[model samples]
Each structure stands twice: as structure tokens, then as C-alpha cells.
Target chain A: MKIGILGSGNMGSSLGLLWAEQGHEVFFGGRTTEKGRAVAALAEQGTQGGTNDEAARFGDVLLYTIRGINPAEVLTSVEVLSGKIIIDCNNFEIPEGFAYAPIELSLAEKLASQVPNARVVKAFNTMAQEVFELAPSPLKDYQVSVFVCADDAQARQTVMKLAEDIGFTAVDCGELRHSRLVEGLGNFIRFMIIGQLQNPYTTLSIDVLPAASEQRLGGRQP
Target chain B: MKIGILGSGNMGSSLGLLWAEQGHEVFFGGRTTEKGRAVAALAEQGTQGGTNDEAARFGDVLLYTIRGINPAEVLTSVEVLSGKIIIDCNNFEIPEGFAYAPIELSLAEKLASQVPNARVVKAFNTMAQEVFELAPSPLKDYQVSVFVCADDAQARQTVMKLAEDIGFTAVDCGELRHSRLVEGLGNFIRFMIIGQLQNPYTTLSIDVLPAASEQRLGGRQP
Candidate 1:
């Protein structure tokens, strides 16, 4: 599978490297071409470096890592995003580094409106960069969960495959309208780990614990 | 400890019964005296039924289960809630039964302002009635977690002990302001279990799984 990573920051670089290691054709895109190339080079092979537009047009699936209120400015030049699986892992952040979008609609909803034809799936936004660096997310001997939400079922499934490829247990949360809940969950976990409980990065991973003897969608761990 | 439960609905009754069984003197307060008495009667002993004001003045710790915009209207008749630990398990709900305030401040925050003197601790609003009814909350051999948050550290600890008395692993999330995150988390879990994923009540319990070998506050399961 071809995966394009827009805004080659910590999330983009980390995810791009992982996907490249999994034998996917990964493209790292950013304004700083050298930085993008540097991230691509870390993958060893089967990865390319390019500008945002070039990466946008290169892949079957495009993963966005940009953060801000205005997504239109970022995707304005990207012409080939329509009819593509776009995984939105971006979230709006306040000064405190907790996720918050002042707008009535969520960032995912805003992005969907901006790119009308793109199959926008909200996934991986809830995870912290430090957790991604853990490789297989060694938490309680269970696969750490990555929740995906989108209107398009197929697009959600595709994003789930991508999440599973990264060794995450992908669970379908709901439609894009439910992105607010996902983002809020992210903030909740952040506050619990950093703000209140002061647990270290290695201490927490979102894993669903099913009731005894009950079957769930995601493979139950232990 | 004497526990006064305001709004003798399902939540108030279920929790009051549990506390009563745990040897705490419990009072069920409601508009309908018979209904409150009936709920209290289930516990057999160590429980009483009373009006809202009677319950308000009865206990050192008061737990509210009412859900409405105007908290003042309900607490106006009560003379002394000051210098008391108030357990706020109330969550604002929309027509869909999802937790939401649609206001600037959370229910716990608003309740704090209205009472002025009570130390408001938010806990148990996130758990479903089914889980509370479960004698031990049978979830993956681990006790289901109940998160608590409040400004007063002593009050928070008191509530955490209360939560433990009822067979839940009570986690201190943060200050009372973080109640918004708890409410959001309730909505997120509700959406996952009922709205989207459609997992049964018998299949879900809020559990935190930390990375292996990491020191965490609440007792690590497994």
C-alpha cells in the first residue's frame, strides 16, 4: 500500500518510518524538504521525500499531521486528495497542549468540507507521540487501541488496516460527527496522565477491557 | 460515615444500597417519600428515607444524582451544605441519553458554585447502572475503575475511599474543573458501547491498562 504523510513532524515521521518498514511505499511531505528527506531516509528503503502537493498526489492513502484551526490553507494546493482515503491524525491544541477546537464543528468535519471528495477518517489523533515510539505498544500484553471514525465504512476499514499494520487494535468508534468525543477522550487521557495522575509516558495505553466471557470486535487480550 | 443520596432515582438508589451494605448510614432523598423508602427498604438496615432537605441536613457526605440546569432550585431549601464533602455523580444528559452539558461549565462546577461551601467531588457519573448493580463488576478479573476529581485533596480522598467501599478502583483524575473531561469520557464510552460499537453492558467496563513494569497509582491488574 502507498502511504503519504503530510507535515513530517514527530507523528508523521514516526508513522511513515513504521509503514515503510512494513514494506509500504511511504512518502514524507513537508515545507522543509531536507527534514522530509531525512525522515524518509530513516526508513532504509521503499520511501520517498517530496513537497506537500507531490506527496498528496503520490499515495492511495494520505495521512495528515498538521495542527491549526484553518485546514483549507494547508490543503489548498493538494489537488489529488479527492476520492482518496485520508486519515486525519491532526488535532487542535491550546496553549496547555490539550486538544480543543473552538469551532462548532470538529477538525475532521471541517477537513471533510474542505476536501469534499476525500474519504476522511479520524484515527491515531488520540495517541501521543511517545506511545508511537514504543514500537508494539507494550501495555498489559494487550494491543493498544486506535479508534477510527468516518462516514464511509470502506474508508474506515482501510484506515483500520493501516492502524493494524502499525500493531494497534483498531476499533470503529462511529461517524465523523463523533470526532468531538474522540478528541475529548484524547484530552481526558492527556489530563489524566500528565495533568493529574502524573503517570509517565510508559505507563498508559488505551486498552479496552471486555467483561468476563463477553466477545468484542477487537481481539480480546488476556 | 453517613451518606445522604439526593434524587433517589436509579443511580442514587443503587449507590445508596451499596454503601448501606458496606455499613454506612445511608439516606435516600426524593420528592416522593414512598419511592425513596422503597429503595431504602431494599438494603434491609442502615438506611432511611427522607425529603430533599432532610437528607441534605442528615449526612456528613452528600451525593447528588439529580440532572438539571438549575441546581439552586433544588438546593435552595437546604440550610447547611457548607463544610461538607459533596459527591457529585450527576451528569447532564440530552434526549439521546448521552452525557452532555451544552454549557460553559460542567455540572460539578456549577454545583460547586451554587453550594459555595461544599467540596464537590465528581465520581461514578461515568459508570452505567448495570456495572454498579454487578456485585463485583466482573471485567477481565480487574475491578472497574471510577475516576474522581475535586479541588479539595482531603475531600477527593474521602470520595475515593467511598468508591473503594463499593468495589471500584477509584482513580483521582485531578481538580474539579477536569470534570468536563470525565463527562466527555462518559459520552465517548457511551457512544462506543451503545451508539456505535453496540457492545452490551455485560461486555464493557472502564479499565486502565498501563505498560508493563511501569509504576501506577491504582493497583495494577495482572
Candidate 2:
């Protein structure tokens, strides 16, 4: 799969490396040429970095990792990603240092509206950037659960396979309405860090020992 | 020490029953006398259930389990609760449904404001009602972790002893502002259920084992 990543900051670059390492043709779409080339050069799997339009046109799967506030204008500006499986990882809250609620519109839902024909899925928004970059598998043999939300079944299935490729347990979270919860979980990670007086490292990832058939109802204690 | 519960709903009543069974004088309060008595009668600890005011006056330390939307209002209505050590367990998110970002006031801060003399420390917001009620702790052998947050040093230390009595692992989460993350983690639990199409019973418990001393500073491996 050819992966196109818009916004070559820490998150985009980190994930871009993962996809490229997973035998995917990864392309970088940075705000500047230097960043794009620099990220492209970091690839061991022939990852190439290009303009947003060029990267958008060159890939089968795209990741939207831009900041929350300006995603609409940025996506509109990137017009290259007209129709594709665009994974929405952008969150809406700004680091204004004040906690607000009733986040009127979600960045994912807003993107879906703008690109009606595109297959958009919401994920990775629930995890910390560092967690996304690190955090080992919760399940030893199987995969770590990743909550995925989208109206399109095919799109979700495709994304799930990608999650598996990247070593994850992809749990289908009903529809786009769930993106609200996913993003909420993401922001909550930040809150937990401050609460623990621990530097933001990522959420505490649990190692789930698989249950026997009788114990499979849910991950409850015996 | 006597235990006080500020709500007679499933969560509050459930914990009240457990504490009373453990031979503690438990006072559980609800909006109505009827609801409180119904739950308290089942406990058989001579547990008293009455108006919120009665619960506030009854307990040595108060456990607040009300909705976050109106923590200030709840405190205002129960004015006698001033100057007490409060177990603050609430999140201020709009209940209509999950919104990506909560566009409202921070309820904990509001709570701090309403009860100026009260010593507010956050705890019990992360557990499932079932875990708080039924998860047996073999006395520090396998106690669950619950983070505590507050500005006052004495209040935090006092709650630490109270938390041990309740069979939990209470980690002090810095100051009052840190309360947001402890409460925010609750949003992750809420969203995980909403996002993954799972129930509270099955999904809420994230069995976080004690982070090994070396692991805590080393890395967050869950």
C-alpha cells in the first residue's frame, strides 16, 4: 500500500516511518521542502516525500495529522486528496492551556463533510503521540485493540488490516459519532499525565493475557 | 471512620453497601428520601439514607459522587459540607452524548470555588462501580490504583489513609488542577464503551497492575 502523510511533524513522521517499515510505499507531505526531503531521507523502505498534492495523488492510504484548528483550511488547500482512504488523526483542541468542553464540531466529521466522496476513518486520536510511536502490544499473540470508527464498512476493514499490519487490535467503534469518544480519550491522556505528575509518555498500556473459551465473555476477573 | 456517599444512584449505593458490610458507619444520600432508604435498607448496616444535607453532616469525611455538570450547584445546595475532606469523583462533560471536546467549565475548579474551606482531593472517578463494590482486595496484596489530586498537603495525606481503608492504591496526582486528568481518564472509559460498542460491565475495567518501581521511571508499559 502506498501511504501519503500530510504534515511532517513528529506524529506524521513517526507514523510514516511505521507504514514504510511495514512494506508500504510511504510519501511525506510537509509544509516545507526541507522537512519533506528530510523525512523522506529517514525512510529505509524507499519512503519519498513530496508536496501535499503530489503525496495525496501518489498514495492509496492517507493520514491527516495536522493540528485541530486549521485542518479544514489545510485539507481544502491540499485538494490533492480528493478521493482516498484518509485516516483522521487530528484533534480539535488547541494547547491554549485552558480546558474547554462541548467541542462543537469534530475535526474528523468536519473533514468527512468537506470530502464527501473520500473514505475517512477516525483512529489514533485516542492515543498519545508518544504512545502511537511506542507502546508495545497489549496482547502477546494477537493484537492490541485499536478503536476504529467510520460509516463505510470497506473503509473500516481496510483500516483494520492496516492496524493489524502495524500490530494492533482494531475494535470497530460503530459509526462516525464515536469519533467524539475517540478524540475525547486522546485529550484525556494529556489530563492523566498532568494528574500523575508524570511527564507525558503515553497512556499506560496493559498486557492482556488471552482468556479461555469460558472466560472470553469479556476481560473480567474470574 | 464513617463513610458518606452523596448519591443513592447505582454507583453511590453500591459502594455504600460494601463499606457498610465491612462494619463502617455508612451514610448514603440521594435527592429523595425514598431512594436513599431503599438502597440503605438493603445494606443492613443501620446505614442511613436521606437528603444530601444529612449525608454531609453525618460523615467525618465526604465522598462526592454527583454529576460534574453541576458540582458547584450540588455543593451550594449542600452548604454544610464546608471545611470537610472531600473525595471528589466527578467529570464535567455534557451528558447529551459524546462531543469531541467538552465545551464547558471545569467542574472540579467550580467545586473548589463553591466550597472555599473544603479540602478537595480527587479519587474514585476511574473505577467501574462494580470494581469499587465487588472487586475483592486481599489487603494490599492486589489493591487497585486510584490517583489523588489536591492543593493542600494535609488533605492529600489524610485521603491516602482513607483510600487504604477502602482497599485501593491511591497515588497523589499533584495539585487541584491535576484533578482534571484524573477525571479526564474517566472520559477515556466512557468513550471506549461508546466507541467500541461495549458495555460498562465488560469495558470499564482496565486492570492496571502496579507499575514496578523501576518501570515507573523507566517506561510506562502498562
Candidate 3:
């Protein structure tokens, strides 16, 4: 698969390197040409680095990893990303302390509205950059569950497969509107680790488990 | 400890029964005396039934289980609940679809502001009534984790102890403001099960796991 990473930041570079190492053709792109080239050099598999516009047109799938308030401005410059699967890993700014932004409109939803033609899927925003560094599988006993939400089933499946490619258990979390919940979970985890648990980002990854099968029957037994 | 359940609903009744069975003095209360008495009958230990006002005055700690739009109205009617630990388990109504209510001010925060003297702790709103029905432990391999949050340390600890008494592993998730995150997790779980997974309420319970210890060190080891 051809993978285009739109930012040369920690999250973008980490995931881009993982995908490239997984034998996917990856293009690392950002405002800083030198940093983009430096990140692309870390990949053992086929990889390249260029401007955001060049990378946007170069891939079957694009990862919007630019951590900014508005993604529309950056993405609008790309001439041809129509019908491509765009994975959104951008989260709104965390205010001082641990309180998250009051999510009136989700970033994924906003991006979807901006690019009417593309399929936008929300994933990978819940965990920190250190989490992505442990690709394919974490050192934990439980699998790191990634919640993927998108309107298009095919697009969601593509993103889920991409998540699986790097060793994440992707759970379908329904439509684009459910992005609010996913984003909220991300913020909550951050708050729990930093503000409450007082633990560093490296020590923890969000893992969800299922209930026992026998307990599935509704109502109390006589 | 004297446990006052201010609503004879499923949540109140189930928890009140468990606490009563655990040898705590439990009082079940609601609008209807007959219903409160019937709920109180489920408990084996020392328990009683009465109106909400009577229950409010009867205990050192109170569980507000009445599902209502405004909790301030219900709590204001009872005088002298000052310095008492109040556990809030009420969740705001989510409309027909998966969209959650935009909670600008959390119910726990509102209740805290309303009754300036009482200590408010938000908990148990994440799972369904049937979950409380399977008390002491779930059928799964791991113990179910319950998250407890509040402004008052002593009050939070009291609620955490109460949660543990019912066979739950209570995790302290910081101050009262973190209630929004806990509540959001509740809503998100609901959306995933009902809206996305299309699974019925009987089939699920929220389960969270811990990460490995070695993974806590920041950055990759080159």
C-alpha cells in the first residue's frame, strides 16, 4: 500500500516508519523538508520524503497527522486526494493542566465536511507517540484496542487493515458522528494518566476487555 | 456506615441491597413508599424503607439514584445533609440517536455547587443496572474496575471503599471535574454496544485493563 504521512512530527514520523518497515511504500512530508527527509531515512523499506502536496498526490492512503487547529487550510492545497482513505490522527489542543477542549464539533467531522469527496476515518489519536513506537504489538499482556469510526464501511475497513498491519486490534466504533466519543476517550485517558494517575505516557496504553458470555442474557434469573 | 439510597430504581435498589447484605445499615427511599419497601425486602441485613426525605436524614452517606433532569430540585428539598458523602450515579438522557448531550456543566459539578456543604462523588453511571445485579465479581477472569472521582479526598475514599465492598476494583480517577470523562466513557460504551455493535444491553459490561511495567520508560531504546 502507498502511505502518505502529512506531518514530520512525533506521531507522523513514528507511524510512517512503522508502515514503511511493514513493506508499504511510504512518503514522509511536512513544512520542514530536512526533518521529513530525516524521518524517511529511518525506514528500511521503500520510503521517500517531499512536500505535503507531492505526498498527498503520491499515495493510496493519506494520514493527516498535522497537529493544528484547522486542517482544511493545509489539505485544501492538495490537488488530487479524491476517493482516497484519509486516517485522522489529529486531536484538539489540550488546555493547561488536563482539561480537554469542549468538543462542539469533532476534528474528523470537520475534516470530512471540508473534503466532501474523501473518506475520513478516526483512529490512532487516543494513544501517545510512545505507543506508536511499540508497533505490531506492545509489551503488555493485553492487545492495544484502537477504535475506528467512519461513515463509509470500505474506508473504515481499509483503515482497520492498516491499523492491523502495524499490530493494533481495531474495533469499529460506528459512524463519523461517534468521533466525539472516541476523542473524548482519548482526552480522558490523557487526563487519567497525567492529571490523576500521575503516570508518564510511556507506561500505559488503553486496553478494553469484553464481558463474559454467560452474563449476556437479560434480566435476573428466577 | 449508614447507606441512604434516595431512589428505589434499579441502580439504587441493587447497590442498596448489596451494601445491606454487606452488613451496612441501608435505607431505600423513593416517591412511592410501597416500591421502596419492596426494594428493601431484597436485602438480608439491617435495612429500612421510607420517603426520600427520611432516607436523606437517615444516613451519613447518600446515593442519589433518581434519574431526573434537575438533581438540584430533588436534593434541595432535604435539609441537613451537610458534611455527608453523596455518590451521584445519575446519567443525562441521550436523544434517539448516538449523539450525546452536550454537557457544559457536569451533573456532579452542578450538584456540588447546589449543595455547598455535601461532598459529591460521581460513579457507577458507566455500566447498566444488570451489571450491579452480578455483584461481588463478574463471571470473567478479571475483576470489573469501577472509576470513582470527587473533589473531597475523604469523600472519594469513602465512595471507593463502598465500591470495593460490592466486589469492584475501584480506581481513583482524580478530582470531581474528571466526572465528565467518566460520564463520557459511559456514553461512548453505550454508543458502541447499541449503535455500532448492535448488541443488546444484556450482552455487555465495560472492562479496562493495565499496560506492562517496562513500557513506561519514555522514548524508544535505540
User: Tens digits of per-residue lDDT for model 1 on A1-222?
Assistant: 988888898889888887887789999988767777887887767689877766788889988888653445765454588788888887656436443433356778888887888899998876566655554434324456687889999999998988888677787876887787776766666666566555535122333445434534332222
- DockQ winner: 3
DockQ of each model against the real complex? 0.26, 0.20, 0.37
Query: Residue A213 in model 2: shift from native, Å?
Result: 14
Q: What TM-scores do the predictions have?
A: 0.85, 0.73, 0.87
Ranking by lDDT: 3, 1, 2
**In model 2, what are the clashing residue pairs, if there are any?**
A101-B102, A101-B103, A101-B104, A102-B102, A102-B103, A103-B101, A144-A169, A146-A169, A191-B181
Candidate order (DockQ): 3, 1, 2
Model 3 residue B96 lDDT?
80
Go through the candidates in order and give the C-alpha RMSD of each one to the true structure.
Answer: 5.2, 5.6, 3.8
lDDT of 2 by residue, B1-222 (tens): 676788777667766776676677988877777777777888656888887667888887778878654445554454676677877777655354554354344456677776787887777676556454333343233445566778888888877766666666667666777555555556656555443444443232222222333243333232
Model 3's alpha-carbon lDDT is: 0.74
Give the clashing pairs for model 3: A202-B216, A203-B216
Candidate 2, residues A31-127: lDDT per residue as tens digits? 7667787999987778888676667777888887876544446644545655688899876563544353544566788878877778889977644
